[model samples]
Target: MMRYLDHDHDWLVAHGAIHTAREIAQQPRLWREITATLQASAADWQPWLNDLLATPNLRVVMTGAGTSAFAGKTLAPVLRERTGLRIDPVATTDIVGDPQAWLDPRLPTLLVSFARSGNSPESVAAVELADQLLPDCRHLILTCNPDGALARYAAGNPRVRCVLMPDGANDQSFAMTSSFTSMFVSAALMLGAVPLADAAARVESVAALCEAKLALWPQRARQLAIDGFERVVYLGSNGLAGLAEEASLKLLELTAGRIATRFDSPLGVRHGPKFMIDARTCVLVFMSSKPYTRRYDDDLYAELVGNGIAPQVIALGTGAGDTLQVELADADDLWLALPYLLFAQLFAFEASLAAGLTPDNPCPTGEVNRVVQGVTIYPYPN
Candidate 1:
């Protein structure tokens, strides 16, 4: 009897909708705020980032909790090539669980914390543990919640620098949409790649494309859900592979585990993991725009079609292809990530509804949260 557009769940529906239109409409405002933040604070940020880069033993650890963690994973490859620095995308969960193995006391390290709340126990604990373990370590906290612990931790601490994302980049929704993309953008710019002036056009173009394309994604996803696929296998490569992980998690979380999902690189799935595919599963491939990358993606595409194991298969990228293909118009992989992510978010939202759950609060059981919960922080003795 509950209608999807019922007023009772207005807030939930509003927040859960991650269409191309929403993202595109937000482009101008988000980019303006993002660029302004860097321009106004470049003098201060540049020196700090330079200092971190100057260290010969500098190990840039991109970290966060849940969706926040995926932001780093999505950027690690691009950052490595742009900065030519050793960058590792480590989860704060893993870091908090075992500090010694991750934080070598001998290595002078830089912990780049990507937190939406900046207050996740794991986020706070990872920073504290790193300082306690590493002989020489610096903290760069990037988050939307400025009042959260991570942002304020930089106060009076010369070793820490906190960069806050633009307003609304924090996302009021249960899921991270614009917030995830903006933070990744800030990191990519601050760490390396396109200058502020040059970044303008690309950002505008990508945002515009999203707005134009996102309109029909939700309907498409909803229809797919109606087909009743019980499982999903998402495949991508490099940066997109990390995105595949986030996409998989979103469906699992939003469906309250009702829709089992798994993700792996294009090549990695061909291994033993291929067994997960069956007639009831939906296979989604995020093909790369680059020719070299697309070759691998195509190979997997061909394999999946050949196997004819899954009931459905969707391929998304920058070119026309057999089967269901979403060809992005001449955009880099980084920009391509936005539209791809929107598809994932829409799919998860549809799945949540298909399972008769609220998209905004998929798990009212309190097992998960918009910002996480019930994590006890232990004191790290100096």
Candidate 2:
């Protein structure tokens, strides 16, 4: 049996976790492929993207459901700061229910949809509603499943441009691992302010850093998993704050509610959410690399340590003495997110295993599904 990280394939497969484990392990390679693919295909989509971005008063809305939705939340801040574009990260669930609240009929809108399966009811409905409500709306569909409804919906449409993620990005696991990171990297490279060549170099550096961290993380994650923490809280700032949301969801999904989880920005946690911490809780803070943001992150880390309420507290970043360090001092918080996320992913995977739940499909009872089920689409009143 092949060994993945610390476990043999037979053991992982018997535990129903091989797919999830393999998917998590393959992210670095997949990210490289995504970067290369974007660079190679820039000619086909760049003109369209350039033209749409060039439009005065263009609103960029990033939409998706579940983990896919978190992608937008993570990227929108960085994109807005760097590109100076008016970008909004709205969930498809929200858009589907009330299009008027999100879609502006007066502005030329670019709907950037992120989906692993591309078949969610809300995802498809959001695209359709944007077209109906906004006369000058265009779509840039980023998805793993080419045959899915969202991808197929873009076929031959002059107003829509669809980009397929690298093969194997369509994660077979119930939870998204490789799919999330691949799509996140793709969008960062294509829509971010960095030039393609520079973006590729940054990606390479991040990927290598992650590869090194992944080698050392599984052991630490396994230890944390078996440490008997009943709750986990993830905290960060800015883009990393959005990523903290996704990281929190992974543990909740993989453990099938065996471990309760919550996420908040470093500064935001001081409000009411800090009450979630207790003796049985484990806290993971994703520290920002930016000097300005790192102050807030460090202050929270110090406060948490000083409180001594949680059983375990971990800080992740390029800083010294962190539970896990990636050593990318020059990298921005956006680039640092990749490595920080990998730590969260591995921890969730190990925690699931420790809880004796199937990482591949935690709820085999069908209450939850790989692709969400039983969602009904309602028509918008004209």
Candidate 3:
């Protein structure tokens, strides 16, 4: 009798969207599970991580590919500020392409991989390249699949630690939903963005807020889909910019490229990307909670509404009027991202349905895959 995005299980299953709908709806639950799971697994990863993090010359690199890659981008900004460490969000694709350039053999390194499957060709190859190229590289792998190559890569290696996400976080859907958010927050918590005492509370608060958004957003999402936007743009700043990238990708993937999409920061969009807006376009701005950043977002939002370049331009954060409003005040942009993400995922799902495409598998011909294929990983010189 479970329902998702206002659609019952039977209806969703009949439409071939059961996986996508259920996965999107279950993210808040998976996020809560991540808090408890990480807390319980602290005994295993904390000792090694504490000492590694304390290393004076340590450089942390977060990596993954595709949607998984976006997780690093979303987190790297805040994690750098909170941990007071040099955290670079380097995609696995970059590392695999040129290991010598990306993986520094000279510095003491901790490679934190945020991967959903852990089996992506680049994901595995990047880890190997790091080991081959760096003398002092330690691995912290956060992934959903325990049996994925990245997890097994830790089996006998004392330099590696694998942390599995909560149940149902593996994401049966083609696009990442529960898997992405769970790993996104998992990296935040495990890397000391929130205090140990406050981690569980912070997670619980965001999860509950997102639970409410899951209910409120679906109807609006359906209406937006019905209106049939031919182009979409997502805007934000800092970590939210990364969230914007993922948001843009979700809509693009769900609609099977029927709707073109672009993402940029509020200020950056004015540079040139604003031209993506047209009469049939939809523009969504992910407003930051920070006062300074919020001003730029306000400027952009007001300009978008005033110019009327796009048919629908909206703000997705707290404000007095016409904003979708995530409704959690005084939270970090890190936490605010979760509820905002829920809205994007739901809208993408509805857009897929409105386009008469299967939300679960928008690409039936196998051009795009749930897991990427056909990439040959060459051996790196030892």
Candidate 4:
């Protein structure tokens, strides 16, 4: 029997999950390293970042593919509120398909590109398109792979600055674990309101909280997995909603579609997506740390419990009596998101194991790949 966080390498390899499990377990440590990397390199990027922020009517576009894209989605709202910049989270998939639609040449653009491998055709294509179309466009490439095409593209480019994540963040598993959170934390430190000193302190606290959650959540998550829920629904609001989307994708990817999953904001769920809930569904709600937002989150949590539709309903946050509680007092939504996400990652990993799927390469038949394959990039008409 494979155990969570305590299994031998032989057992993990036997279960075909050593890579994913190790990557998941290494996140907190990697997050601390990311914090240090960001601090050490602040002098290199901060001046350029400050100058960019000073520009009037600057348009910041955060673009990436798949989970990388969700990093942008998760941070845009809070970054907009904090920086007062007009920020949009567009996917490279969308940009590559229709660059003219997403890239406005009229505004001075700062394209923040997030990528794990940084070599996805769509990711490289989007950057090339931005350079071609925008009269004044700057690139901030955050990637785990230092040797990736995107990183190489930024070399000695006056208009571009690239930040490489810590080693080991380039996840070996089919799914993104450390790579995702490291990039997310890096962006928050680089762009969010938290100053470098405060950001490092916050990351330490959040990492500690995650370390605790990683230790405690597996048993509960495994139980939920063993319950054999046919579907999973993840809910949150604002930035957490974007996180909910990532959480949903993690479960779906880890299970290799053995479980159907959906994600939506707490209020948005009432619109129509709530229909996804059924008796066999497991609902995981990422509760907001903000008191005002928590009101909405609490209401939904009560409603979901009151309905009694889902076999298991988990509330993950700093709230009292929550199923997965991490009491991060007065933490910004961005920081709180880290621990919340760690819980989601752990839950998904456990669920994948419980479903008898190989978390390392859930789809070994080449249907889905760690790095997406077999795509032909077409030239855009000038």
Candidate 5:
């Protein structure tokens, strides 16, 4: 009767179908809004970005907390290859706890902060710490909330640049559906892909594909969630690896950590984390679109299927696979993340319900939060 948990098999099946379908429909709206924002603001962004690019020794540090951190992680490697600049996704939590290790006083760094609310304590603290530790530091704040701390941070500072995403990107949902995708797109445009005008076609394609496809994912995800797995492991490589991290967190947060979760690269997992797999676990592998990367992913999937460590193994790919194949026409793995992530999010939401937890606020007991709590900001010594 519309309760949180999916008790009936029929109910779970129906829910997963609805969730996937909605994602496919909503993705276009998201893409249009994002492209329009960039086109309108190109004049301002182009000059600012060009100036930042002029710096010879540019160190780009993508900083955020939780899922925001994953956004950076997903973007950093691609940015390094595309821009030929040094980029790293450093968690604000890590920086706040230990400043000296992350902040190099010698390097001329461009601190790119990805924040959804822009008000999180670590978000603000990371920016502040960069200013304190790095002598030649500039700020480039990407956020959905214009009134957020990161957006307003550039008000008087000529050195700081702030780019506000589309209004819908500041998603009001319990989870970061549009917000996550929008921010990731913005970073890709500003850092990796072609100019705003050039990127319009590809972005539109990606959005259209996702909207057309999301309708049926909810039912699929619901079934997977109700499979009664007690553990989940997400695997990917490169940028998709960062997405795997985000997927893992989504399941853990939505389920209030009731389901033990872990994420690692396809190659990295073989080294040690493979032990996390068990008979009751579900392994979700994000296969790459590139031929080379896909080889590694294919090998690991074969190993997982052959070893039979887990009862359920799901692999998301652009084409056919042994199980749970979600085709994405001819898109790259980077863009494929949109559909893969939608599936993961729906799975986690359904899993949360199956575990008898609320999706809106999974942690009422106060461990994890929408905007994390109880993080005391310490004064750094000069």
Candidate 6:
């Protein structure tokens, strides 16, 4: 009996969740494969990136939509510090709408686009707008589909470079599971200031950690999903806040919005978003690995646990708290992000099953699509 996420393969397929479950379960192996793939092909793309990154006053804007967009947001702060480059994680929706506001035609810019399919109308529109507005602009597209629009756009274009993730990184599930983390890892390794040798080692460690979590989290997550919770809150700080956004979305998406979800920074929640918490809320905080940042995360963990409002408060990462710890105290937030994302994905999968919804396609009516349909891309003014 072949099983994924502790459920029989036939069982998941019958429930229309096989694709989502397999994609979620296969992420750790995909992480290792992508690292190896990137390391092998470094010679081809490294020189081009070296020149672009070395540009004076270089501004790197990472853009995508939904989960793809969250990947850049999660890594932007860390990359800014590590690469010593001015990096902003902007959304393609924002870029396509008002190109003049988000883009500066004067600066030498590296537009890093993250996408699973690379077919979003706004995504391709953003790339075209950058070429039109910024003469000094160069593009780095990280996509899973080699045949995607962005990948096709890279052909015969000297200003663009496209890196396809491992073969199966192209997820088939309506909700992105492996594709999100694969792109996130690829971006951190290639774009962040980490050396290639060190980057390889980091991927190994993080992949192992997540593999263990995937094996262990499914049953526990299923139990939590059946706990009668009405709302879920995901809280984190710094880069992890972007992760929290992705996590919150995963739950809402997988459960077809049957479970209310909210995401915020530990401190930011107090500014008024904390009102989402009640007796039925389950709060999961992605604790930071940095000591200073961990202090803030720990403070929120204690406050949430002591508040007597939410029924469950989970703080997982470096330090000990109300919930379990990942033993990644010294790991960079970027590496720790993989395992954190795995847990969130697992919980979302289980929550979907508990809600009697199909994780593969929660919305069967074509209202919310896998590739995002019905977006009309209008031409930007010159």
Residue 319 displacement (Å), model 2? 1.4
What is the per-residue lDDT of model 1 for residues 341-376, given as tens digits with 9 covering 90 to 100? 877877877778778876667777787788778878
Q: Which structure is stronger by TM-score: 1 or 3?
A: 3
lDDT per residue for candidate 6 within 1-382, as digits (tens), equals 8899999999999999999989998988888888888889999888899888999999999999999899999999899888789999999999988999999988999999998999989899999999999989999999999999999999888888899988788999999989998888888888855788777777777777777877788888889999968999999899999999999999999999999999999989999999999998999999887888888888888888887888899887765444756865357788788888888998999899888988899999888999989988887778
Locate the minimum summed-lDDT window of 10 residues in model 6: 320-329
* Model 2 lDDT, full chain set: 0.90
Tell me which of candidates 1 and 4 scores higher on TM-score.
4
Cα distance off (Å), candidate 4, residue 152:
0.8
How far is 133's C-alpha from truth in model 1 (Å)? 1.3
Locate the minimum summed-lDDT window of 10 residues in model 1. Answer: 1-10
lDDT of each: 0.79, 0.90, 0.90, 0.89, 0.80, 0.89
Give the Cα-based TM-score of candidate 6 against the true structure: 0.98
Candidate 3, clashing residue pairs?
A: none
* All candidates: CA RMSD (Å): 3.5, 1.0, 1.1, 1.6, 3.9, 1.1
Q: TM-score of each candidate?
A: 0.90, 0.98, 0.98, 0.97, 0.90, 0.98
Cα lDDT tens digits, model 2, 260-289, are: 999999999989999999999999999887
Q: On a 0 to 1 TM-score scale, where does candidate 2 land against the true structure?
A: 0.98
Off by over 4 Å in 6: none
Candidate 6 overall lDDT versus native: 0.89
Q: If both were scored by lDDT, which would come out higher, candidate 1 or candidate 4? A: 4
lDDT (tens digit, per residue) of candidate 5 on 1-382: 4322223435644433333223323556877777787788888777888788778878888988888899988888767877788898899999999999998888889888888899999999999999988999998888889998888888888889887876566755445656777788888888755566678887877776655555566678889988989999999899999999999988887787789999999999989899999998999999888899899899999998999889888888865664656555567766778878877887887888788876656676766666767888989998
Q: Can you list the residue pairs that collide in candidate 1?
A: 20-214
Question: Distance from true position, residue 259, model 6, in Å?
Answer: 1.0
